[model samples]
Target: MSTQTTQTTQPMRTTQTWRLDQRIRVTGGEVAARVLGEGPPVVLVHGTPAWSYLWRDVAPLLARRHTVYVWDLLGFGDSRTDPGAAPSIARQARTLAELVAHWDLDAPALVGHDIGGGTVIRAHLVEHVPASHIALVDAAVLGPWNTPFTEHQQQHADVYRTMPPDIFGDLVAARFRTATHRALTPESAAAYLAPWAGSEGQRRWLDQVAAVSFEDTREAVARLGEISVPTLVLWGEQDQWIPLSTGERLAAAIPGARTATVPDAGHFVAEDNPADTAAALLRFLA
Candidate 1:
């Protein structure tokens, strides 16, 4: 693999400032995405409570050499979902399959983070989406992936769904804070918080949380050995949500898969340490 590294001196742009205006109709709804750069194609997927903005810093770096495609999953970010639509892992995977087809990409490199990782894996294995390379960054591919917050939300969905917008925003912000090792700047925090600011956003957020299930991930785990593409399992060394050991095991399970860890980052590695995260991806994709 290539060991090249990229350095940037430009001021870091906040996720709030990142805009994805392109919309594509998928299975259930329209997904917001943006394509950048040239060369070979790459698709980046983000996890729960996060939109493509999660890749605001990392995508630009990768776009320097690769055509980067970033999208917000159905029901998240600027994406539109049908009323009462649940953005489950399985459903998202199907959408991903359709997206790959829509993009008409031929064996493009795929990168996913958190639940996005689950979506990518399921799309490749279950949906039979082909990729030249696959990278999972702090992915939730193992069983018992749900947190106490998710468990409680799943059990009492109605309660959270009706939570006042201010309270719900506070709750979401608190949860998001825990995903990173370092403090997020006010601008960065606002960018993440923007999607879940209103009643509709709150309902969509709860719907996604309620849709979280271990079954989808368990199915992917059972088929890990069946993966044919080059795989890279990347994790945040300080991930409090899913420990690094899980990533190590995931890498070990996939035949010939490699592993890399980003130090000083938690579950949200991209936001906490985008430089190293992007570098790791560049090195692998090279």
Candidate 2:
């Protein structure tokens, strides 16, 4: 594994060991990305409302054995973006595809969570991004992904955008807490909530919420069999966002794909069970 002498930084409100940080240009703006280790490439992609911080624990450990690259999706984390733009799954997937080419990661393994899982799949199916392997953890690729809350936000986007900072902060914090089987520590909660804590952040939060759409996912789900790379589907047994049954269906849909469950975990399996998640990934990568 590689090491940098620079002190750890808190760009997204957490201790990150990743270095070689740079802004890679994409469609609308640049996306923040970092690379670690020096072996076969492994890309960690996160979904909405989260940045590369989602894989803080898993990245370094994986880096010990392989090159690990993590990045924040456009409009989230330290990545520059347009606050007025609505979220588009196709756009995020295109960004991921472009990054893979820009990084020159030939046949890199992709591990994605939440909408990230969908992003990688869309990149493979629609954008034809070459991937050696894919692992979906509590992914939103299967269907019926948009929740009532997300639907309401899309419906009342104007009102949600004007919500008070404190009110929006509290609402997001509450939702993130319930995302995991275990309670998030105050520090961790604050770190995850940091991005959307201020006035400007509140507006971005509304934009992020309004951007949520399942239309692209619906299209990708229908073509799951088209993916030829080896794939693994990992899900939190107790995930409230995307259920275990969805994981099972996903595994079955993909050719020769296998499924596993992280016990006592919710949608945020890495946060709840990093060790098990890492172990599962190591086995698949091997």
Candidate 3:
């Protein structure tokens, strides 16, 4: 897994492409992540039911001036997940600690989305992982997540446990272009869903989501300030995933964290507005 992976490029061309090249086996499970560009390490951790593809645009853009690394958590993308392994925030943080250690990353900056934010926060809290900086988009951390899931969402999650693979895959793929991120082009939509299609990895994602306990997530949210790193908070003003008020509270809670509301964007901030998202990130990471 040490070999470099040449990633895909199209309308938004990178100087080059890198495949899902690196592999790190941690605690009896293998974690797969892709490394691209050349400079200091920046790890991008994707949120629920998504892989590194979530950062396709931001990865290449930042790679223009810095090293970019995107990884599939053990239960998502091409990464391996043990069926019996715990999928809680604490467990995922341990897995993340394994990832940073295996790569020998010293003080690597991290960008985490959705559930990934909670993962990184817990890693900082319990593992004391060094941080150059951290950026959280939408409602990644668990606080205020008690807002009700739509009836459609509840039905869908229930259907997922037993849905046919092809149809279920289509549903997963469709999430990239839902009413959430209206600015996504067809190509961009297809690219994000590509990795989750027809893979056992997708099933593991469903498993993890089904196992989530709202109460436990709330408990984890209470421990967030254990994260001492400088933090940047970006919220989509139009985001339906979580309210903007939550983002305000999140920023105020974390020392030195700042919040920027991207107008007209949703939870998938980088896709709907790549330039704004990247610019905001570059400024914070600077």
* Most accurate candidate by lDDT: 1
- How many backbone clashes does every candidate have? 0, 1, 8
Weakest lDDT window of 10 consecutive positions for candidate 2: 1-10
lDDT (10s digit) by residue, model 2, range 118-214: 9989888888888999999889897778767788888887777778878877888888987889998776676678777788788777777766677
Tell me the TM-score of each prediction against the true structure: 0.93, 0.92, 0.81
**Model 3 segments more than 4 A misplaced:** 1-18, 144-159, 166-174, 194-202, 214-220
Flag regions of model 1 displaced more than 4 Å. Answer: 1-16
Ranking by TM-score: 1, 2, 3
| Shift in Å, residue 255, candidate 2 | 1.2
- C-alpha lDDT of residue 237 in model 1: 89
On residues 154-218, what C-alpha lDDT tens digit does candidate 3 reach at each position? 44776665677788777666555542556566665655565555645456656666555454456
- With candidate 3 superimposed using the best TM-score fit, by how many Å does residue 56's alpha carbon deviate from the native? 1.1
- Please give the lDDT score at residue 52 for candidate 3: 69
User: Whose TM-score is higher: candidate 2's or candidate 3's?
Assistant: 2
The global Cα lDDT (0 to 1) of model 3 is 0.69
Candidate 1 lDDT tens digits, 1-286:
1122232333223253688857677767778778899989999999987888899899999999999999899988878777666789998998888888877887889899999999999999998999999999999888688888888999988898878889988899999899899998888888888878889778778878878798987888899999988999999988988889989888998999999999999999999999999999999999
